[model samples]
Target: MIICHCQSISDQDIRAAVDWMRAADADTIITPGKVYHALGKRADCGGCMPLFLDTMRQCDSFGVATAAERPPILRPARLRLAQAR
Candidate 1:
């Protein structure tokens, strides 16, 4: 279950970090770097990146917010005027 061999990170560690982050800030975006920082570690070799990303993707709160979930996009005044005309 070790995701990062260099940093000695486990699947449990990843899950714990993710849960803690989500609890701290629901809107906060979780990434491998943040997870590593949360665990008081950092990525060493670039090799573990793929597995690291896979483990992160396994987490429930790992995806970006959908358009409907995000705030409405606003158009620039010039663009709006052009469209209106």
Candidate 2:
């Protein structure tokens, strides 16, 4: 499934790039521009953004690398702890 027609980027390519980026730097922020840079291309137009974002979120390793990286306040337990303090 092609995600970005301008860059000739496919869903698989995006997945691979996402996995590679995650593996390379667990804390690194992944974005469409970064993916395009990784693939040696660029976004020609804003048309593919919706599908592009969907494919990116579908990736398994598509989130923060560790529990600490996630927003602590977002967790109920942590929220309670913060309130306690």
Candidate 3:
């Protein structure tokens, strides 16, 4: 399915870009702009954003990871043992 008509980006393209990005850098954040760049395209009209985002969300790699879900808290285990502090 075409997600961004202006860029001719499809759902597979988006997923491929996302997976490529994730593979390139696990800690990197994925965005539509990056996907466009990866596919060597750009956004024209802003109209496709809604469907674009919907398609993006369908990817398995499209959500916040557990570590990024919330800020860490100061604790004895983290500060003394794990040193995550």
What are the Cα lDDT values of the candidates? 0.79, 0.86, 0.77
After superposition, candidate 3 runs with Cα above 4 Å error: 65-85
TM-scores vs. true structure, each candidate: 0.72, 0.76, 0.73
Candidate 2 regions off by >4 Å? 65-85
Of the two candidates 1 and 3, the one with more favorable lDDT, higher being better, is: 1
Q: Largest lDDT belongs to which candidate?
A: 2
lDDT of 2 by residue, 37-68 (tens): 99998899979999999999899998854555
* Poorest stretch of ten by lDDT in candidate 2: 65-74
Better-scoring candidate (TM-score), 2 or 3? 2
Compose the digit string of candidate 3's lDDT tens values, residues 2-38.
8888778889999998888988887776788988899
In the order shown, the candidates' Cα RMSDs to the true structure are: 6.0, 4.3, 6.8
